[model samples]
Each structure stands twice: as C-alpha cells, then as structure tokens.
Target chain A: MSATAVLRVDNLESYYGPIQAIRGVSLEVREGQLVTVLGANGAGKTTLLKTISGVMDPEKGTVKLEGTEIQGNEPDRIVARGMVHVPEGREIFPLLTVAENIAMGAYTRSDKAAINADEEMVYSYFPILKERMTQAAGTLSGGQQQMLAIGRGLMAKPHIMLLDEPSLGLSPLLTEEIFDIIRRLNTEQHVTMMLVEQNAAVALDVATYGYVMELGRIVMADEAATLAASKDVQEFYLGISQDENQRGQRRWKQRKTWR
Target chain B: MDFVQLIVSGLANGCVYGLIALGFVLIYKATEAVNFAQGDFMMIGAFVCLGLTNADFMGLNFWLAVPLAMVIMAALGYLFDWGVLRHMFGQSQVSIVILTIALGFILRFAAGTIWSHEPVSLETPFAGQDLRFGGVVLGIDEIAIIVVTVVLTGSLFVFFSKTKLGVAMQAASQNQLAAYYMGIPVKRIQSLVWALSGAVAAVAGILFASKGAIDPSSGLLGIKAFAAAAIGGFGSLPGALVGGLIIGLVEPLSARFAPDGFAGIARIAPYAILLIVLIFRPGGIFSQTQKKKV
Candidate 1:
C-alpha cells in the first residue's frame, strides 16, 4: 500500500430518514490498492458507497479524495473529482445506445481525442460492447449490461472507483469473468477501488485488504489473505467449518464474537 | 379545391399545435411532470411579442420582437422551474399534476390582468398575402408556419443526436440518477429543458398570432396541443407533430362535413382521438413499454 491514502472516509454516519444506515464507519484505500468490504444484506455496504459517492449525503462524517474534503458535494461534482460509482443492479441507461451510454460517462470531459481513445480502450476490455455499439443498452443480457456499466464508469477516467455488487445476478462463470476484469483494471491500469460485495470469497481473492461489516458496523478488518484464513470468517462468511460435529457451537461462538 | 385548402390550413394549424406539444414532451421527458401551464406559457409568448411590436408599446420590428419574446419566455421558464417546480420534485405524481394545473390558472390570470382581456392581431409583412398553386391557395402565413416547423424540428432532431450537451440532456431525461453519477448536472439540465420548452412555446405563440387574433384565452389552445402530445406518445417528439396533424385535420373536417348535431363534435375532436389512443395503445404510438427488472 502507498504511504498516502487516495480515498478515506472518517467517522461516517448516514441514514434513510429516521433509520441509520451507516454508523461511524471509517476506512481508507491507498493509491493503487483494491479494497473490498464484505457484508451480508442490510449490512450498510451499499449505504457506505452511496455516502462516499454523494448519492446519499452522510448525516455526519467527511469523505476525502486526495486530501480534499468532498462530503455533501453533488454526485456529479464528486464524479468530476476523479471518483465514480458503479451502483448495484448496474444502472445502465436503458434507453441510450451502448455507444451513447459510454459517451455520457465522459459528460464532464471535453478533450475529444482523449475521450475517443478512452472509448476505444473500453471496447478493448469488452469487445462485445463494440459489436453492440448501436444497440440499446436495455437489450443487453445481464452480464453484458454489467460490462457496459463498468465501461461507463471507466469513461470518466476515474482514479478510484466504488463498485457495488458487480457480480450481482451473474452466473458463476460470468462472475469470475467480471472479477478477472476488475483485477486487471486494478493491477494493469493502477486504478484504486473500494468494492462492496456479498460474494465474500470471490471478493477476497482480488482484494488486497478487506473489512467485514454487520448491521451498519465493521466487525473485523485485516489483510485479505489473513481475513480469508481466519476461523471466524471461514465458518460464517465463507461457509466452511472444519469441525462438522461442532459446527453449530462454532456458529454460536462466531456470533458472540461479532456482537 | 376548398377541401384541399382546408387540408393545407389544417396542417399549418396542426404545426402550431405540434410545436406546443413538443414543448410539453420536452419538459415532461426531463422532469416527468405534465406541465398544465404549457398553454399559458404560449399565451405569455404571444402577449410578449404583441407588447414588443405594438406601436403603443416597444414598437420593435417583427424580426426583433419575436426573438426578444422568446428570450423573455425562456427566462420565465427558467424562473418557473427554479423558483416553483424544483421544490415540487419527488412529490407524488398527482400533487405535481395539481400544482401545474394551479400554475396554469395563475399564468392565465396574470396575462389577463396585464393585457386587459382584449384580443389583438399581430402585424407581419406576410399578413394577408396568398400564394396560388393552380386551384389550390395557401396563405403566406401558412407557408411560413410549415417552413418554420420543419426547420425547427429538423434542427432539434440533429441537435439531440449530434451535440454533446443535447446527448447529455437526453441521458438526463432517460435516467437522472445514473446521469448524475456520470458527472452530468441533472438539476441544471432540468432547468435548461424548461427554458428550451419555453422558447419553443414562444415560437408557437408567434406563429399562432401571425394567423389570427390572440388574447389571454389563446393559451387555452395549449389544451389541444396537450391532447396532441398524448395522442403521439407523451415523450416522443415526432409523435407530437403527427398527433397535432391528426387533431388539426379532424377538427375542421368534422365541423364542415358532420351532419346535424354531430357538428359540436369538432370542438372535442382532439380529446376524442386521445380517448381512442388511450383505449388502443396506452403507451402512445411512439412509446416503448418499459419493463422493470428485479
């Protein structure tokens, strides 16, 4: 990890009306690192990403991108500052053509030559998109739409990306393919990422660091390999218990530790 | 020849309605609110042009007056959204509809107060002139209306497809939240859409005034245009024009040719078409049914 963090969230708090969705969450992603937040449904994973990207304003806390405080800024402004969010469910512009969808990702940019080059680069990552450039995005199959979503995010030339469940609704083969592209984007392009996922096992494989959250709180944090090897994580998250006879007892013990 | 003339005149009138309907579609696509004040916006445009060109007021040339009116109307549209409509964002669809209806009444009342409820004609160089195509006769004003509609609609089509800002506006219209995440200023785009709609309404106003007299009630024609929009597919631009033409043709045709008591049906011709369209194809002719995925 780099000495300086590219992105950081400090004492963050967010809510959906009266219900607090994220509670005093703090985390950092150093430059060129792939960090993953592994949590179950209702674990505030999506809320944290939404707050950082300015989709939903945090009630309390600060988000810093390269040391600039950007909390409560408009989502577009946050995107302009080199951070983009590929939201859960892959919110691709259904009515727009695949090419037009990618063009919109560069809405804040004006350099025509660079934008064209970036677009071609996106095509290289997903050649299928090049074939379907004129087709409406809504017509795409689920995996293809996911690729288009990520491609749209890359069109912004983001320094750090916040990906929320990229593997959602994908077959196992497609999920592995998507994760491979994510890994390549991190390693080859040197793009920093903060990924939120329910697929903890696959996420841990690509992530350099990981955090485990439950019900709006981080229960454990460690290096990805260390966390993956932890007995608590193996039993509960990875769904692997070595002692089958005491599996129920171990599950109870893990719950007690997390609480 | 009389029938042909009626067809020509109806088409010109339909072009005017189509222009107003286009404005409604533009605003609705961006914000999803069917602005009831659209017709009143047209009324304001006509009144503004009249005020500028009348000898008693600014007395500007027809050329200068029309553009000035459009600019003022555009500003008014921006203010309407920035000051009033923006606050209504995320409200229930019913409340927003009611709010726009209330806004329509306010605009009509304001226009009546300012213009004194008197009907006035807009003077243009082409007024009272006619062109003869063998047995078929077309008014110079009618020709101007057709030409302007074609040019404006064509430019708009190109603009949306070819320009960056235009594409951004379309993207914002399609999915505001997704566009926002891509660094497009969605709120600003909404304001811009309103302004553009206002400018188009101004054109419709000027064109209508060129044909005949205009008063505060002239904005009521916007209701016909709204019907036109509904007939075309509320969000489709080309659909607005086709729907307007259909309404335009049906009205005069029914009035002139209908037997006995059926003559009154001309007044409700546009609404009649709307009902038929709603019954047959609720999405309108041009609208694609959207399917939400889980």
Candidate 2:
C-alpha cells in the first residue's frame, strides 16, 4: 500500500443527541489497503463509519477523503465524492429487483458503457447475484444479501468503500466466503476499504492494518500481523480464551491505548 | 343498453375520483403523510385552468391551458413541501394531518378569492359532443376521462419501473436512509413526488371542470377520493382506481336501483365502501407492498 491515505478521520467526535457515540477517534486508510475496526457491540465502531461516510454529522472532526475535508456534507454528496457506504443490517432495496438494486449503486455514474462493464465485474465477484438478478432483492438469503450488499458497493467503482459489518449476521462459512472476496477485491481490484467488524479473527486475517476500539475510543492500532499476535486481542476480541476459569480476571486488565 | 350506458358514465365519474385518489396515494406512498388538502389542490387546479382558458382571464386555448395549469400546480406543490412540510419532519403524523387540513382551508379560501363562490363553466374542445354505439350513448368527456386516466396511469407505472429516477424514487420510498447511502437525493425525490401528485390532481380538476359547472366547493369532492384511496389501500396505485370505480358504480346504481325514498344515501356510498373496507380488508385489494425486512 502507498503512503498516501485514501481516508483520514482526525479526532472525530459524534453524538446521538446528547450522548457521544464516537469520541475523538482518529484513523487513516492508505490507498489499496483493507483496514478493519474491531470493537464490541457498543464501542461505536458503526458510528465511526457512519460519521466518516457522512451518514451522521460529526460534532468535532475532519473527515478527509483523499485529503479533501468532507465532514458534515450530505451523504449523497459524500457518495458522489467517491466513497460508498454499505450500511449495517444490509439495507438493500427490498422491493426492487436484485438487478435494479445493483443499478441504484451506479446511480451517480452516467457512462453507459463503463457502467455495464462494472456491473459485469460485480457479478463476477458474486456470481449468485447474476443468477438472481431479476428476482426481488428481499428474496435472497442472508448470506447472499450480504454478498449483494458488497456487490452493490462494487458497482459504484468507489475510491474507498466503508463496509459496516459485512459478516454481521452470517454463518461462519459465509463470513469466510465474503472475507475471501473482500481480500480478492483489495489485492486484485485495488479497492481501498475500511471495514467495521466484530468478527475480529476473520477481519484481522484479511486486514492490512487494524484498530481496536473500546468505549468509542481507539485503544490500539497496529499492523495486522502485530495485532493478531497481541495477546490482549486474542483474549478479548478473538474469543481465544485459552483458560476458561480466569478469563474474566485476565480480561479485566488493560493492555495499552493508541495515544 | 341503459345498463351499459350507466356503467360507462359511472366509470367516467370514477376516473375523476381515481385520478384524485392517485394523487392521495402517491403522496402517501412516498412520505407516509396523509395530505388532507389533496382535494383543495384539485379545486385550485380547476380554477387555474379556467383562469387560463376563460376569455375574462388569460384567454389561452384549452389545450394550452390544461398543461399550463398542471405545471403551475406542480410548482406550487414543490413550494409547499419545501416551505411548509419540510419543517414538519419528526413531528407526529397527526401534526402533519393538521397542517394539511389547515392548508386545505387556506387553499379553498384562496381559490374562492380568485374564482369567486359562484359556479362557472369551462369551455372545452369536446364539450357537448357524444358518441352513440348501438343505442348506447356516451359523452365524449366521459370517453376522454377514461382514456386519459388509463394512459396517465400506464405512463406513471413505466416511469416508476423503467427509468433511473423512477427507480431511485422507489428506493427512497422503500428506505430513505438506504437510498441516501446509495447517492439518491431523497429530499429532492420527495419534493418531485409532491410535484407529480399536484400535476395528477390538476388533470383530475380539469376533467372535472370539463364535465360540468365548477365552484370553490368542488374540492369537497376529494372526500370521495380519500375514500377511494382508503378503499384501494392508501399506497397502492391500481387499488386507488379500483376503489374509485366501486364508489362511482355504487353511487348511480344505488340511486337508480334502490327502493323508493332511499336515494338520499346514494351520496354516502363511497364512505360506506370505505367503512366496509376498513372493517374487513384494511390492506385494500392490491396491497402488494410489504415493509422490507432489514
């Protein structure tokens, strides 16, 4: 990956009404890199992505996309600037046919020939979407929906894709299948991605770098191999509690913070 | 022959009701806000068309006046959403209902100021023309209503289904946040939906004016359209027309076929159908849209 950052969130602070959800979080994803954010359910991993993608406005932050500050702009404007967010819970257009659902991803593009080629590229990434192209998107199984969600993101030909929990509710096998494609896209398609995942094992396996968040703050940041080797990550996030008896006591200790 | 004539005439009247109901349903489908002023919009549209075509007003040709009136209504509709309704976001649905009801009163008063309370007639190219087919007589106005309604409905279906903007509209209606994530301008699409609804209301108003004399009170006819929308299911396009047809058919048939001294209830037939539908299948006949599972 290049030293130039594709996305940069500096000291971002976001709130849900009065309560802050993402607190002074800073991260950067370099070009052609697959970065993962690891956090528990309430650590605000989703909110961080939401803020960066312009779905939620940040109270104090600068979201720079390719060094252009884009905080507080409308989501569509952010999307037009070449960042596509595949939101959590797979918010695919249900009533629309699967093909139409994919077509919506390319709503901003006007190049008819390039769009058709991109559609083919997306189908190649997820062949099942091609077979179910005419069917209503709602009919797809959960795993396929996740794949479709990612495929929809692929249709944008986005400069950076923010994936919020691609393996959110999928089976382990399906998560592996999706992560395989995610890795393929990063290496082959040169797609820069910042993926929010609680599935740390799979996430760290594919990510070039990872950030571990705790209570809306980044507690750790390191290269993927180093993060994977860290004993604290294995116990807390990776579910690799080797000894069942003292697991709680062992997790009560703090390792380190990024700052 | 008389029965066929009654059916045709009823269908024509239903077309007017159905067109108005379509506006009702379209707005409801996109925003989930019940626009109580839908009829008032029709009232204003008719008056506007009259003002455009009448010798006392703009004195434009009928063909020119119709589209012009529709365009005028569409702009007003866009303004209404941008100015009034946009602020009502996160407010209760009841608040929006009250807002629309107040808008209805204002529209009626404004229309009365422009056109007066007195009834008036509009000059149409096809006025007083009738076609007879094997002893069954049909007014050209009635034929025009049926033909126009069918054609408009077909075009709208194609627009929503085939076009990119139309598909974007469907996406916005289904899930606004998701649509926004996909780069669809949800707010603009919603404002456009309001504009489209206004244009539909204008067509209904013009057809209504073409059929007979009109006054400010003609907007009260929207209650039947509301009934039609409810009967068709609030969000279903085809259901609105079918519901309006039921009301139209029932009105004449109830008046003509009922026992003596019971004709007074003919006017309330639409409401009665609305009541029946509410009591039984509240989802309407063609309630195919389901809330998407996230």
Candidate 3:
C-alpha cells in the first residue's frame, strides 16, 4: 500500500451464493486521487463496490479505510463512515419526491445545520434537481436520474465516493458532462473518487490512476498518461491503432476539454 | 326528520368501523401484511378497557381508563410484531396471511378464557342519552364516536405529513431496504407501526362496545372493518373511512326499507364496493401517488 493510501484491500474475496464473483483481488486507493477501474461486463466491478460498502461481506481478506479495519460492518454503518456507494442502477427511491430522496441521504447526520448546508451544495452542483425538487424521482429522465443518484450520494458528504458505471445508459453529451463533473469534483472539491467504468477511453481520459481488471484480477496498473500511450492498451482497450494513436496525441494537444 | 336521524346514527356507526379499518390500512401500508386478527385485536382493546375501568379492579374513571386501554393495545401490537410477524419475514405472502388467521383464533380463545365467553357492557357516564334536534334523535355516545374519530384521524394526518419520524415510516412503507440504507432503523419503525395500528383498533373496539352489547365473538365486526379497508383501497387511509361510511349507510337503509332478505345484501355493501374497485383500479382511487417502476 502507498503511504497516502486512503483505502487498502488485501486479497479480498467475495461471492454470490457459492459463485465466486471476486477472488483474491488486492488494490489500493490513494488519498486525493481519482482512480478508475476498467473492466468488461461480469468482471466483478459491481461486486467489489458492494463488498467495500458492506452490502455484501467478503469471505476473506482485510478491507481497511484510513488504516482501520471496517470489514463485516453493515451498509448503513459503512455509509456513516463516509464511504458512500452510488449503486449501479441509480436506485433512487422512485416513489419518493426528489427533495425527499435527497433528504433521505442525510439520514445519518446528527447536525441539521450541516445537512442543510450540504443540501445547498448538492442542488448548486445539479441545478436542475432544484427545479423539480418536489416531483417524483421516477418521472425524471434517465440522465437526470443519474445526476440525482450522484447528487444524493454527495448529500452524504463522503470521504471517498464509489460510483458504479456512473455514465451507464447516458447519451454521448451527457456522458461527457458526467465525466467533466467528476473531474471538477476531484480537483475543486478535492473528493477522492474510485470510479468503475467499462468505457476505457473516457476512464483513462479523466483518471489520475488506472487499473485494468479482467476476470476479477488487476492485469495492469499504471499512471493514466503511461497507460493511455501503451501499445498493448491502445490495441486491446483504447481501440487506437498505432497510426491513429499518433493522430490522437496530436488531437489531444489541440484541446483542453477535461481541464 | 326521522330519516335524517337514522342517517346520522349510521354515520356514527360507520366511524367506528372506519377507525378499525384505519388500523388495517396502517399495517398494510407499512408491511404489506393484511392482519386477519384485526377484529380480535379490537376485542382485546375492549376487554382491556373493561378490566381497567371495572369498579372491582383499578376502579379508575371511565374517561381515564381509555388512554390506558389504548396503551395496552399498542403494547400488545408491539409484542405481536416481536413474537410472530418478525418471525414470518421472508415467508411467502400466503403464509403470512394464514399466520394472521391463526392469530385471530388464538386471540379469540384467549379473550374467551379470560372473560368467560359471556357478554359485558361498558357503562359509560352518559349511557342511554339522546339529543333531539327537530324531532330527530341522536345518541350522545354515537356523536362522541364521531368526534373521537375526527380528532384521531386529524392527529394521524399531522403525524404522517409533518413529523420526521412519520416521514421515515412512510418511506419505509414504500421501500424497506432503501429506508434501512438511510439509517431509519427499519425494524423499530415496523414495530411502531404495529403498535399504532393496534391502538387504533382498540379505540374502535371501545367505541363499538359503548354502542352495543358485546361478547368474545363480537370480534367478528373486524370482518366489517376489513371490508371497509378493502372498499377504501387496502392501503389508503381516507378510503377506509369512506368505505366504512358506505357500509354503515347501506345496512340500516336496507333494514328500514326492505326489512327482509335484503338485510344480508345490505350488510355486504363494503365487500361489493371492494370487488368493484379492485376490478377497475387495483390501487384504489388514490393510487396515482405510487407506481412501481418496471
């Protein structure tokens, strides 16, 4: 584990009713860094987040947050410890009002004034949520619901945000906006993020560090820039041919979109 | 004038059933469990009031004993949750319904054991008194039932709408797992809901006993209340009241006009309404508020 590691996982093994979803996987998320785990479908990305958030218990191995073991705690206790999971499907309470959904996220907080302030911060980040605050959450469009899911997680004031496929089912423009929001949250708000994404291109574009997960194991871990330029990554994940890689580098230089 | 008086009396009687139906709605909303033992719980509530207010026992004043009876009924509800309902978790809905049916038998037997299966009348301070208005006669006891139901319903509305705990209960009713994630202490809320429902049943039971003669078998009135709940929409609060009113009106009106075989048909008005409503709109009239996502 690195000296600045905020979360440390040692040989974490998780299962779904005797079917092993994750087997002996080890990873570390460092403080103030945006880390992305890129994996194909059924590669245990969702299971890992569920295990870390205490929704599912790992059969073995230690999971420590800030050097303290927090394995086997319930999801609510894990959430109270400031590790909030924005689940894969944007499971916002459909019948609840948008404002009610946001308020519910602050259920564990003791300080009403602090919760109120956080509520302000969340609505400011997603101004559209404020406009339809009292509307039923199910009525929101797919992109808006995703934004609400992320915003609801933000209402918890998490120390480390674990987002599972945050851009799933979103349009190209909305996907870019979601990633840009992630970038701003990482840099401006200084929130440590661990994003699980199948979109390798966009994940590497915004992430400070990247890990390639195949069959529940980390096959590659490197700085984002190095991984993006690697020939193996270009062919297998990034879909950039050797000639196109050169063109992509030139095109990258002409834009500062992520910054 | 006579017709107006009869309607007023029927409305008052309907309020009693409505109160019990409200209990059915409360538990159904929170747990999605239809408690077949609701009428038996009401019976227990009346028995508790009889025991507490009896001159031979606590010798407590009748008015003073009412709240205590409600408290005892609520405690029984909490115990019932802790003892039976909690154990039935993860069981099929049919199994739960059957378990409640079994509980009804147990409650009836227990009440009979304690009170000897005989009739007992709760003598109120203002028993057998009628207020006459324009040659129309209205029993004070009946008027009292209406007043109490209005007050209780009003307070319950405020509780569900304004309080934080109430909002948490409503959230839990919609999604138990989601409520747990919000740190709402879902188990405790479930228990509280049971207690509240039980207390409401007890109120209805006491009101019922004041209006008529009672025996252990009087718990059968729960059938009428259950019908009222179904008529109003199984999970709706105000629907129960309206169902109860419709049921109440149908009975005497039929008894007065037809005065024969039609009495049975009139008594079943709430059930008929329930069937018609379920056929057209399964969620009830207020179903627009909640819709399941595919």
Better of 1 and 3 by lDDT: 1
Reference-based lDDT, residue B142, model 3: 89
Q: Give the TM-score of candidate 1.
A: 0.97
Give a tens-digit lDDT track for model 2, residues B149-245: 9999999999999999999988898878888898888888889999999999999999998899899888999999999988998888899999888
Ranking of predictions according to lDDT: 1, 2, 3
TM per prediction: 0.97, 0.97, 0.89
* Cα lDDT of model 2 by residue, A1-259, tens digit: 4379989989999999999998899999999889999999999998998889888899997999999999999988888899999999999888899999999999888899999999999999999999999999988999888888888887888999999999987889988999999999999999999999998999999999999999999999999999998877987888676444444444445544343
lDDT of 1 by residue, B1-294 (tens): 999989888998999999999999999999988988899899889889989997777789989998999999999999888998789877898998898888888888898898778888888779999999898888999999999999999999998999988989988988887888898999989998999999999999999999999988888898899999999999999999999889888888989998998889899877988999999999887875556443
Q: Model 2, residue B87: displacement in angstroms?
A: 2.2
Q: How accurate locally is residue B12 in candidate 3, as Cα lDDT from 0 to 100?
A: 87
Q: Which residue pairs collide in model 3, if any? A: B232-B239
Q: Candidate 2, after superposition: displacement of residue B281 in Å?
A: 1.3
For candidate 3, write residues A1-259 as lDDT tens digits: 4548888888999888989998888888998899998888998998888888777899999899888888888777878888888877677777778998888787777789999998998888889999999998989988888888888888788888898998888888999998998898889888899999988899899999988777877778899889888776776677664444544552343221112
> Whose TM-score is greatest here?
1
Show where candidate 3 strays beyond 4 Å: A1-4, A230-259, B259-261, B288-294
Of candidates 3 and 2, the better by lDDT: 2
Question: Could you give the candidate ranking by TM-score, starting with the highest?
Answer: 1, 2, 3
Docking class of 2: medium
